[model samples]
Target: MTRPRYGDLYFGLSDSRNEANQDRDSFLQTYVDLNGSTKRVVRGDKFLVLGPKGTGKSALAWYLQFAEPEGAHLALVRDASSLPLAEVPRLQTGQEPGPERTVVAWKFILLCNYLELLMRDQGCSINRNPEVVRVARLLRDFGFMGDASGRALLKFSTTTVTIPVPKLGTIYKRESSSALNIFNLIPYLEMWVAEAESAVRHILLIDGLDSIFLNDAKYDESLSSLVQAAYTLNQKLMENRATGSVVLLLRNDIFSRIALSLPDSQKMRDDLALELDWRVLSGKAGVGAPLMRLVNTKAGRALGVDNFEVLKYFPDSIEVGSRELGVRKIPTFQYLLNMTRHTPRDMLRLFEEIRRVEASGIFEESGDRLRQEVIHEGVLQYSTKYFVGAISNEFAGYAGGPERAAAALTALKAINKQSFDGDEFRESLASVASGIEVDHRDLLRLLFYAGAIGNSIGGYREKSYMQFYHRRDESEIYLQGNFMLHNALIHAWGLRRTLGNEPESQTGAIPLIDRGAARPRRRRRKWEERKK
Candidate 1:
């Protein structure tokens, strides 16, 4: 019957992968299902999960593999970091070390995993079925029976082995002159899986692809092959009437590059991919939006309350002003959401920062609610620590990428203006472009794609024409048009609110959040009042 303290409520972890690994129960407890992504995966309707960083792709994979839904299923979640991805091209597939060879290698490896799982099921026993015995022997011989890493398993690919089939002769006769490798066992493995049928469905979820990505030709080919292999294997399962599926988690940028070269790129994009985008229409993410609902779910579960109202934990609203929209009152949640790219991790990190500020006693709380001052201070800290670091890490794969991004931020700070023309922007970067290898044009493109800056789409008199990359896909930076800094990076870079050389009326003015305002009286819902 009492409100919970801000320190006592859990906002969930910043890294979903770590949470899924370390504390799965807590991770599942706080998870919020935005769309029907979980159902689509379970029903084998979708296999590819693609999204930008911090969009909860890993979390969705974890939930699909770990959650206990009302169905017969066997799920295996593999972390790609543990697999020997670099050694994939070395495996013998009778082809050059390219995407084609990688596809064959991935198919063999995936079938091997599925066979191991199928053989271990209670329905399958070596004593009952001779095929199970042969499969078990093959797995044990290949070092897959015990705790073997992918590198260890790949070592056995070159070994000569003879697998015999019933009624038929030996498939791969071991001989010094002509010997068959692991690729030759794919068909037999497929038969073993198809023949050993059970009521339970098998699902394999692969995560951590982004962690191992290097943004090079080899990685691009390797990743593309995995995707192709997964699609083909899923189709085979469906055709054979086998209850099995394979799902891959990938970053949107990586997928975009690989999809360009794929023959069936359109089909992959239109039919199989599930994009984990959480961005809502402007001014529409108030109370029940996906990201907001995620916060409420975590708070409710942590505080042991049903239908918990997260807005009660902070001030009602904050006043923000811009040249387009003159001074107006905005909800505290919308104000905070404006500073994020509409990702669950971003919201969680913002709340975590606020909790840290509250714990430091910099701003006193009023009746179990955080003061507006604490929220403001939290946004400032979050921008500098998490936002800047995330941007640098996003571009970490390119040559001198992190340095170039950092230099761009410094240049913006030196410019000390919120908006600038193309000439001013180039001149500002010229001052800081001492050792950076990237040119001014490339730097501008990088900043635009990274969502650090955007292009103005309309004329001077039009309002709300500013668009960022994260918000719209068609938003491009033009050398002749104006450029506005993203709202999320303004505080972090400490830029002034001036157009070219003219300062606005409210330049350097901080939004007035009610720090000493009295907490509003709580109103009981209709059902609660009826119960009373």
Candidate 2:
């Protein structure tokens, strides 16, 4: 929030112009349609944004509204139930306050957008349609003629038209007094269409609604909203292919629950539902294209000596072979510190506190990169809480916990020893390392993915490994990947070799963690008691 130095790094404050640009990008050019490699992506009726919190589902929706990719500006509903079935507006409900209101709000968007556009330049002007005139006559016969006089089907002034209504089909209205009032949805939409020939497409995006507060009965309100909206859009819009879209963005956890609750979740699959798999961005494995875009955007302003010589997001790598392997593709300003994050959100959260601390005047001068205490803190924060998320939740059936996790990291380097072949070291680790047991698999895989360890003649070498960023002046240690990759597991490995030889030496082989400025061995009893 510290203004990001007012350079290219800034995503820009939300204003009218910025909002317009963002909407354009979201609808027309932001995401690449990757179906051409062989076949096309199957377009579906809905788009479910399934990802963890902070993975940017809501941000994407905001971007969609800003882009207005389809032309008409977006409208959001705050709540579905609150929608009176007559009023219409695009819905964009957020998590705070009331999320359910979002669906209810958007249920009325189509009518609102159409009516708004009609009254834009003139008081009221519209194309003539026989169907609309017929429905208008029917409504007039029933004394339902809204506060307007149109020669059958005439241009209604925007100011004169007191409300937003879509020029769709004949509107069927049922007041709360009727038992079938809920079923009046079809008639209400049709009646509006009867007033005009212009087809106003409304893209309703519903967000919020998670299990954080709702009771079990209402926990998957987002899902229920999605189902209902999908049905409504298809039925009212005649399953039209060119217009109307409803995007429901929710967490993968909620979707999973709904899937189990439903008789068949697969039956509802659609193109609009999206999943944000942040794990894929780890290193260069995922987000390769988007990463390039981010880097280009950053490198432009960061290295501002010559703005005209604008370089590609990546430097012309005619020098460093593409397969040489590196992480310049990461976008976070603190990316150099994370050394392990895989998603856009991970990098952001990993350095949020550090960014706050730095901007607070703790670090203002430049050229302190090597000795910056923030680097040390960033390393600790990235690996400690996020990297683990509790070893059990992270590793599932594999061996977890910091200690065993460290050992598994070491084993991965052993498995990929370049002195031999990758296959040889992997087989060796698979056969001998007990810490490489089941649950530990993903941890090791992740380390390899992060490029923390490399197979080489001298075992595994940790090139960028930092030994507490607080000691920036010290030369970094580079050695066998297993020993250098995960310190605790390396110590465990060393102790394993000495176990049959000398008991005292084995005790010395185990490394100690630095509690503060001092490194001390962990007491097994103390740790176990803490766990209990």
Candidate 3:
């Protein structure tokens, strides 16, 4: 039977990167360039991809791997906590959690080092080597490289082969020392890889970094170990010359947990890196450029769209508006366009949803009428769910429960908030959110991450404030980037009051708090004012 055409497959770019070779255009190449900043963020660097969920960090990493740019090798490691007991025995053993996790993670890297080596053209030559034999058998048995009920392992300690002297005859000896502890083996692995082929750089990427959950089960040992490994990895790279890079696709909250674990506060910053931030223009725009590059590649090639073909052509554009005002910001374009707003994820998600809806056969696949109706329904369905899901937490914080939180949403709404300020007007905050506890720097983050709210203004591009943003407007008001309940709380309270449940002292008839009650209005003066 013939294989399915590339167009016949799902648009789920995640984990389906193997299908990328078929599509060719799904590589996400548009966002490779840096913005005005001079930071070196190209693939294969010890960079951190830090942002709230769904910012497309994982997608970009996959794109880079597909591109195979110079010095670009990626590992994509899952955090050790996610490793099954079958994968790593150390997690099951009762011992000092920190040191054990660190050891296991290094061994994890060691496995990646082996895989990268084995996959390379030079590595396949040493296939007959004993070390390669041992390791391969282990991986196969562990199910990492084999089928279900893993019962195999490989025996490749370390091997490098090339057409040059000292390589074709001698293998790059694999050491058994855990670099997370010794901190010297990482350099050795680098040197070994270079020996195999000096021109090749393997990039080690660890996505799903947050999957490594820690608890009293081992007294957080697994996490401590991962953190230690990361620290050592960072130090080694900082001090030595770079042959490749290690990247982690991690959640901000995970990093926050890591920050609290570090013995030295400065080490956290030195070792911990972020790709997305809730801060200035430096945060989302910085990462958005590269991510959009990935989506453009995938959408154009997979869906046959023409606007953003190459990974690089997908230029970032954001929506900016005056909340209390409107402007005729017109531009000349020869082509008729249906203007809409999107972030990198929105572009990909839109494509994915479109593909799914069309293929689901919910409507008769008869003509343009069905397709148009589906598109309209799709947009509304996506928007309503996205808005409610995004603001649900903030709404809950304001209303003090999940029930009222559901009402904060509007059908197919767009981002329209005017500003974000971390300080100043914090006083106006209701006690609704006062009942909850959340991480710092995430007040605005809850809304931003859910892809519900955005900067009403600014960045590489702007969109509705209710829509997620790749950038922020500069002229908006300020609100804390903290875990804030949205302003809809007042309305919720009013509704509850009208239903006869609100406290009489706090309803519209009386102020919730009245300062200087001692001061009284004269009865005659009040009566005359009322009559007038």
**Poorly placed runs, candidate 1 (over 4 Å):** 68-71, 81-90, 96-98, 124-178, 212-214, 319-329, 421-430, 459-464, 471-481, 499-532
Q: Give the Cα lDDT of each candidate.
A: 0.67, 0.35, 0.37
Q: Higher-lDDT candidate among 1 and 3?
A: 1
Best of the two (1, 3) by TM-score: 1
Per-residue C-alpha lDDT of model 3 across residues 125-213, encoded as one tens digit per residue: 33445544454454454444422321221211111111111222123344332211212323433443333333345555656543332
What TM-score would you give candidate 2 relative to the actual structure? 0.42
- Global local distance difference test of model 1: 0.67
Candidate with best TM-score: 1
TM-score of each: 0.80, 0.42, 0.47
Q: Rank by lDDT, highest first.
A: 1, 3, 2
Cα-based RMSD of candidate 2? 17.6
RMSD, every candidate, angstroms: 9.4, 17.6, 14.9
Per-residue alpha-carbon lDDT of candidate 2 for residues 1-532, written as tens digits (9 for 90 to 100)? 2222311332222122343355543223322222121011112244455655444555555554544434443434222322222122112222222434434433433333333333332222232544344433543442223322122112221112222222443332324331221123434543443333334344444554421322234435544544545445544543444334455556565565566544445555443345564433223332343433333333334334213111222122212113544322322321332332223434444343334344445545323232244443434554554444422232222224445545554454455322223344456556656544553334434343233332221111322112221111111222333322322222222322211221111112111111110221134335546768
